[model samples]
Target: MIDYGSEIAITGDDPMMDFRADPDLIEFIEKLGRARNHYLSLTRGDFTLLYENEGMAVYTRSYKNETAFIALNNTSEKQEILIPTDKLGSKKQLIGLVNNDLIKEQNGNYPLSINGEESEIYIVRDNHGLKMLNVIVIIAIPIVFLILYFYIWKRGKNNG
Candidate 1:
Protein backbone atom coordinates (compact mmCIF):
# COMPACT_ATOMS: atom_id res chain seq x y z
CA MET A 1 0.00 0.00 0.00
CA ILE A 2 1.24 3.47 -0.85
CA ASP A 3 1.33 5.47 2.33
CA TYR A 4 0.24 9.06 2.13
CA GLY A 5 0.87 11.22 5.17
CA SER A 6 -2.14 12.10 7.33
CA GLU A 7 -1.59 15.76 6.48
CA ILE A 8 -2.27 15.01 2.84
CA ALA A 9 -5.91 14.63 1.94
CA ILE A 10 -6.44 12.24 -0.98
CA THR A 11 -10.08 13.18 -1.37
CA GLY A 12 -11.93 16.30 -2.55
CA ASP A 13 -11.90 18.06 -5.88
CA ASP A 14 -8.71 17.11 -7.75
CA PRO A 15 -7.97 14.27 -5.36
CA MET A 16 -5.27 12.80 -7.60
CA MET A 17 -3.37 16.07 -7.98
CA ASP A 18 -1.26 15.32 -4.92
CA PHE A 19 -0.82 11.71 -5.96
CA ARG A 20 0.31 12.75 -9.44
CA ALA A 21 3.07 14.92 -8.01
CA ASP A 22 4.81 11.79 -6.71
CA PRO A 23 5.92 9.55 -9.57
CA ASP A 24 6.57 6.54 -7.37
CA LEU A 25 3.15 6.84 -5.74
CA ILE A 26 1.53 7.14 -9.17
CA GLU A 27 3.17 3.95 -10.37
CA PHE A 28 2.28 2.15 -7.17
CA ILE A 29 -1.36 3.22 -7.41
CA GLU A 30 -1.54 2.15 -11.05
CA LYS A 31 -0.16 -1.29 -10.24
CA LEU A 32 -2.52 -1.64 -7.29
CA GLY A 33 -5.49 -0.72 -9.47
CA ARG A 34 -4.48 -3.23 -12.13
CA ALA A 35 -4.09 -5.99 -9.56
CA ARG A 36 -7.39 -5.20 -7.88
CA ASN A 37 -9.28 -5.08 -11.17
CA HIS A 38 -7.73 -8.31 -12.39
CA TYR A 39 -8.77 -10.11 -9.24
CA LEU A 40 -12.23 -8.62 -8.81
CA SER A 41 -13.37 -8.58 -12.43
CA LEU A 42 -11.85 -11.76 -13.79
CA THR A 43 -11.88 -14.17 -10.88
CA ARG A 44 -14.77 -15.62 -8.96
CA GLY A 45 -15.67 -13.98 -5.68
CA ASP A 46 -14.30 -16.93 -3.70
CA PHE A 47 -10.59 -17.31 -3.11
CA THR A 48 -8.39 -19.82 -1.31
CA LEU A 49 -5.20 -19.03 0.57
CA LEU A 50 -2.87 -21.54 -1.04
CA TYR A 51 0.13 -20.78 1.11
CA GLU A 52 1.59 -18.31 3.54
CA ASN A 53 5.06 -18.24 5.03
CA GLU A 54 6.77 -15.47 6.93
CA GLY A 55 6.32 -12.29 4.95
CA MET A 56 4.70 -13.82 1.86
CA ALA A 57 1.17 -15.01 1.08
CA VAL A 58 -0.39 -16.81 -1.91
CA TYR A 59 -4.06 -16.84 -2.89
CA THR A 60 -5.96 -18.54 -5.70
CA ARG A 61 -9.39 -17.97 -7.24
CA SER A 62 -11.21 -19.88 -9.97
CA TYR A 63 -13.67 -18.49 -12.50
CA LYS A 64 -15.25 -20.24 -15.46
CA ASN A 65 -12.51 -22.33 -17.08
CA GLU A 66 -9.66 -20.29 -15.61
CA THR A 67 -7.93 -19.95 -12.27
CA ALA A 68 -6.07 -16.91 -10.91
CA PHE A 69 -3.10 -17.09 -8.56
CA ILE A 70 -1.97 -14.03 -6.63
CA ALA A 71 1.22 -13.79 -4.63
CA LEU A 72 2.18 -10.96 -2.34
CA ASN A 73 5.51 -10.34 -0.68
CA ASN A 74 5.61 -8.06 2.33
CA THR A 75 9.27 -8.35 3.16
CA SER A 76 12.03 -6.12 1.88
CA GLU A 77 13.57 -8.99 -0.07
CA LYS A 78 12.44 -10.90 -3.12
CA GLN A 79 10.80 -14.27 -2.60
CA GLU A 80 10.28 -17.37 -4.69
CA ILE A 81 7.67 -20.12 -4.38
CA LEU A 82 6.92 -23.34 -6.20
CA ILE A 83 3.24 -24.14 -6.79
CA PRO A 84 2.11 -27.51 -8.04
CA THR A 85 -0.21 -27.56 -11.04
CA ASP A 86 -2.46 -30.06 -9.33
CA LYS A 87 -3.25 -27.39 -6.74
CA LEU A 88 -4.58 -25.20 -9.56
CA GLY A 89 -6.61 -28.02 -11.09
CA SER A 90 -6.28 -29.00 -14.79
CA LYS A 91 -4.54 -25.98 -16.23
CA LYS A 92 -2.11 -26.00 -19.14
CA GLN A 93 -0.60 -22.51 -18.84
CA LEU A 94 -0.10 -19.67 -16.39
CA ILE A 95 -0.40 -16.22 -17.98
CA GLY A 96 0.43 -13.09 -16.05
CA LEU A 97 -2.50 -10.71 -16.46
CA VAL A 98 -0.86 -7.73 -14.80
CA ASN A 99 2.65 -8.01 -16.29
CA ASN A 100 1.85 -9.90 -19.51
CA ASP A 101 4.29 -12.71 -18.71
CA LEU A 102 3.71 -16.38 -19.51
CA ILE A 103 4.84 -19.39 -17.45
CA LYS A 104 4.39 -22.90 -18.70
CA GLU A 105 4.04 -25.84 -16.38
CA GLN A 106 7.39 -27.55 -15.85
CA ASN A 107 7.81 -30.90 -14.14
CA GLY A 108 4.27 -30.59 -12.74
CA ASN A 109 5.02 -27.34 -10.89
CA TYR A 110 5.35 -23.60 -11.50
CA PRO A 111 8.06 -21.49 -9.95
CA LEU A 112 7.22 -17.86 -9.26
CA SER A 113 9.40 -15.01 -8.08
CA ILE A 114 7.92 -11.81 -6.65
CA ASN A 115 9.75 -8.63 -5.79
CA GLY A 116 9.78 -7.13 -2.34
CA GLU A 117 6.45 -5.64 -1.28
CA GLU A 118 5.03 -6.47 -4.70
CA SER A 119 2.01 -8.47 -5.78
CA GLU A 120 1.71 -10.63 -8.89
CA ILE A 121 -1.40 -12.15 -10.44
CA TYR A 122 -1.48 -15.00 -12.96
CA ILE A 123 -4.29 -16.63 -14.91
CA VAL A 124 -4.30 -20.37 -15.46
CA ARG A 125 -6.21 -21.53 -18.54
CA ASP A 126 -6.44 -24.48 -20.85
CA ASN A 127 -5.10 -23.91 -24.36
CA HIS A 128 -7.90 -26.01 -25.79
CA GLY A 129 -10.58 -23.57 -24.63
CA LEU A 130 -8.82 -20.62 -26.23
CA LYS A 131 -8.39 -22.52 -29.51
CA MET A 132 -12.03 -23.57 -29.52
CA LEU A 133 -13.21 -20.04 -28.82
CA ASN A 134 -11.13 -18.73 -31.71
CA VAL A 135 -12.56 -21.34 -34.04
CA ILE A 136 -16.11 -20.49 -32.98
CA VAL A 137 -15.50 -16.78 -33.53
CA ILE A 138 -13.95 -17.39 -36.97
CA ILE A 139 -16.93 -19.46 -38.11
CA ALA A 140 -19.50 -17.10 -36.53
CA ILE A 141 -18.16 -14.01 -38.30
CA PRO A 142 -18.67 -15.39 -41.85
CA ILE A 143 -22.08 -16.74 -40.96
CA VAL A 144 -23.10 -13.32 -39.62
CA PHE A 145 -21.84 -11.64 -42.79
CA LEU A 146 -23.74 -14.09 -45.00
CA ILE A 147 -26.95 -13.49 -43.06
CA LEU A 148 -26.59 -9.72 -43.39
CA TYR A 149 -25.66 -10.02 -47.07
CA PHE A 150 -28.73 -12.14 -47.84
CA TYR A 151 -31.01 -9.83 -45.88
CA ILE A 152 -29.72 -6.77 -47.74
CA TRP A 153 -29.90 -8.50 -51.12
CA LYS A 154 -33.50 -9.57 -50.51
CA ARG A 155 -34.48 -6.10 -49.33
CA GLY A 156 -32.89 -4.44 -52.42
CA LYS A 157 -34.59 -6.88 -54.80
CA ASN A 158 -38.01 -6.24 -53.30
CA ASN A 159 -37.49 -2.46 -53.40
CA GLY A 160 -36.34 -2.56 -57.05
Candidate 2:
Protein backbone atom coordinates (compact mmCIF):
# COMPACT_ATOMS: atom_id res chain seq x y z
CA MET A 1 0.00 0.00 0.00
CA ILE A 2 1.14 3.55 -0.75
CA ASP A 3 0.57 6.53 1.55
CA TYR A 4 -1.36 9.23 -0.33
CA GLY A 5 -0.68 11.91 2.29
CA SER A 6 3.02 12.05 1.56
CA GLU A 7 2.49 13.27 -2.01
CA ILE A 8 0.53 16.39 -0.92
CA ALA A 9 1.68 19.09 1.48
CA ILE A 10 -0.34 19.19 4.69
CA THR A 11 0.43 22.70 5.97
CA GLY A 12 1.93 24.69 3.13
CA ASP A 13 0.93 26.77 0.13
CA ASP A 14 -1.13 24.92 -2.47
CA PRO A 15 0.72 23.55 -5.46
CA MET A 16 -1.79 25.11 -7.85
CA MET A 17 -2.01 28.47 -6.10
CA ASP A 18 -2.52 30.63 -9.17
CA PHE A 19 -5.42 28.70 -10.70
CA ARG A 20 -7.29 28.11 -7.45
CA ALA A 21 -8.83 31.57 -7.31
CA ASP A 22 -9.62 32.05 -11.00
CA PRO A 23 -13.35 32.72 -11.52
CA ASP A 24 -13.40 31.76 -15.19
CA LEU A 25 -11.55 28.52 -14.53
CA ILE A 26 -13.86 27.70 -11.66
CA GLU A 27 -16.94 28.35 -13.83
CA PHE A 28 -15.49 26.28 -16.66
CA ILE A 29 -14.74 23.39 -14.33
CA GLU A 30 -18.25 23.53 -12.89
CA LYS A 31 -19.74 23.51 -16.37
CA LEU A 32 -17.53 20.61 -17.34
CA GLY A 33 -18.68 18.65 -14.31
CA ARG A 34 -22.30 19.24 -15.21
CA ALA A 35 -21.65 18.13 -18.78
CA ARG A 36 -19.98 14.98 -17.55
CA ASN A 37 -22.91 14.14 -15.29
CA HIS A 38 -25.34 14.66 -18.17
CA TYR A 39 -23.31 12.41 -20.43
CA LEU A 40 -23.28 9.67 -17.85
CA SER A 41 -27.02 9.93 -17.36
CA LEU A 42 -27.54 9.68 -21.12
CA THR A 43 -25.38 6.58 -21.35
CA ARG A 44 -27.40 4.75 -18.72
CA GLY A 45 -30.48 4.56 -20.92
CA ASP A 46 -31.30 2.53 -24.03
CA PHE A 47 -28.33 3.42 -26.18
CA THR A 48 -27.82 2.22 -29.74
CA LEU A 49 -24.66 2.54 -31.76
CA LEU A 50 -25.75 4.04 -35.05
CA TYR A 51 -22.51 4.44 -36.91
CA GLU A 52 -18.78 4.31 -36.44
CA ASN A 53 -16.19 5.20 -38.99
CA GLU A 54 -12.48 5.90 -39.05
CA GLY A 55 -12.81 9.31 -37.43
CA MET A 56 -16.32 9.54 -36.10
CA ALA A 57 -18.78 7.72 -33.85
CA VAL A 58 -22.53 8.19 -33.67
CA TYR A 59 -25.08 6.85 -31.26
CA THR A 60 -28.60 7.36 -30.01
CA ARG A 61 -30.13 7.14 -26.52
CA SER A 62 -33.79 6.73 -25.84
CA TYR A 63 -35.74 6.96 -22.60
CA LYS A 64 -39.35 7.63 -21.66
CA ASN A 65 -40.39 8.27 -25.27
CA GLU A 66 -37.61 10.85 -25.64
CA THR A 67 -34.59 10.27 -27.79
CA ALA A 68 -31.19 11.92 -28.22
CA PHE A 69 -28.40 11.60 -30.73
CA ILE A 70 -24.74 11.93 -29.91
CA ALA A 71 -21.87 12.28 -32.33
CA LEU A 72 -18.18 12.48 -31.64
CA ASN A 73 -15.53 13.45 -34.12
CA ASN A 74 -12.25 11.87 -33.15
CA THR A 75 -10.15 13.35 -35.94
CA SER A 76 -8.69 16.78 -36.38
CA GLU A 77 -10.69 17.45 -39.52
CA LYS A 78 -14.34 18.38 -39.72
CA GLN A 79 -16.70 15.55 -40.51
CA GLU A 80 -20.22 15.38 -41.87
CA ILE A 81 -22.44 12.47 -40.84
CA LEU A 82 -25.63 11.38 -42.45
CA ILE A 83 -28.05 9.62 -40.12
CA PRO A 84 -30.96 7.65 -41.47
CA THR A 85 -34.29 8.52 -39.79
CA ASP A 86 -35.47 4.93 -39.91
CA LYS A 87 -32.66 3.94 -37.61
CA LEU A 88 -34.18 6.25 -35.03
CA GLY A 89 -37.61 4.57 -35.64
CA SER A 90 -39.14 7.87 -36.63
CA LYS A 91 -38.27 10.91 -38.69
CA LYS A 92 -38.23 14.10 -36.72
CA GLN A 93 -36.53 17.42 -36.37
CA LEU A 94 -33.39 17.22 -34.35
CA ILE A 95 -32.57 20.14 -32.08
CA GLY A 96 -29.11 20.80 -30.74
CA LEU A 97 -29.08 20.67 -26.98
CA VAL A 98 -26.13 23.02 -26.56
CA ASN A 99 -27.03 25.66 -29.16
CA ASN A 100 -30.77 25.13 -29.78
CA ASP A 101 -30.22 24.84 -33.52
CA LEU A 102 -32.72 23.03 -35.73
CA ILE A 103 -31.66 20.14 -37.97
CA LYS A 104 -34.10 19.25 -40.70
CA GLU A 105 -34.41 15.88 -42.37
CA GLN A 106 -34.13 15.66 -46.12
CA ASN A 107 -34.41 12.63 -48.37
CA GLY A 108 -34.78 10.32 -45.39
CA ASN A 109 -31.45 11.50 -44.04
CA TYR A 110 -30.48 13.95 -41.35
CA PRO A 111 -27.11 15.59 -41.80
CA LEU A 112 -24.88 16.63 -38.96
CA SER A 113 -21.48 18.23 -39.15
CA ILE A 114 -19.02 18.48 -36.31
CA ASN A 115 -15.70 20.18 -35.86
CA GLY A 116 -12.43 18.58 -34.89
CA GLU A 117 -12.43 16.82 -31.55
CA GLU A 118 -15.95 18.04 -30.94
CA SER A 119 -19.05 16.26 -29.73
CA GLU A 120 -22.65 17.19 -30.40
CA ILE A 121 -25.80 16.21 -28.51
CA TYR A 122 -29.16 16.57 -30.16
CA ILE A 123 -32.75 15.92 -29.00
CA VAL A 124 -35.18 14.38 -31.45
CA ARG A 125 -38.62 15.97 -31.51
CA ASP A 126 -41.45 15.81 -33.96
CA ASN A 127 -41.85 19.11 -35.83
CA HIS A 128 -45.52 18.30 -36.47
CA GLY A 129 -46.74 18.94 -32.93
CA LEU A 130 -48.13 22.30 -33.90
CA LYS A 131 -49.75 20.90 -37.02
CA MET A 132 -51.41 18.19 -34.95
CA LEU A 133 -52.66 20.77 -32.50
CA ASN A 134 -54.15 22.73 -35.38
CA VAL A 135 -55.93 19.67 -36.66
CA ILE A 136 -57.39 18.99 -33.21
CA VAL A 137 -58.62 22.57 -33.02
CA ILE A 138 -60.20 22.33 -36.48
CA ILE A 139 -61.97 19.13 -35.58
CA ALA A 140 -63.19 20.48 -32.24
CA ILE A 141 -64.68 23.64 -33.75
CA PRO A 142 -67.52 21.84 -35.56
CA ILE A 143 -68.35 19.71 -32.55
CA VAL A 144 -68.45 22.76 -30.30
CA PHE A 145 -70.79 24.53 -32.76
CA LEU A 146 -73.10 21.51 -32.91
CA ILE A 147 -73.31 21.32 -29.14
CA LEU A 148 -74.15 25.03 -28.90
CA TYR A 149 -76.75 24.66 -31.67
CA PHE A 150 -78.48 21.80 -29.83
CA TYR A 151 -78.45 23.62 -26.51
CA ILE A 152 -80.01 26.79 -28.07
CA TRP A 153 -82.64 24.75 -29.89
CA LYS A 154 -83.63 23.00 -26.67
CA ARG A 155 -83.85 26.30 -24.78
CA GLY A 156 -86.05 27.82 -27.54
CA LYS A 157 -88.37 24.79 -27.51
CA ASN A 158 -88.79 24.89 -23.74
CA ASN A 159 -89.50 28.69 -23.73
CA GLY A 160 -91.83 28.75 -26.73
CA lDDT of each prediction against the hidden true structure: 0.73, 0.73
Stretches of candidate 1 off by over 4 Å are: 1-19, 23-28, 31-44, 128-160
Residue 118 of model 1, lDDT score: 79
Clashes of 2: 0
Error of 2 at 10 (Å): 22
lDDT per residue for candidate 2 within 78-124, as digits (tens), equals 99878887886455888776545678888888888888887777778
Residue 94 lDDT (model 1)? 73
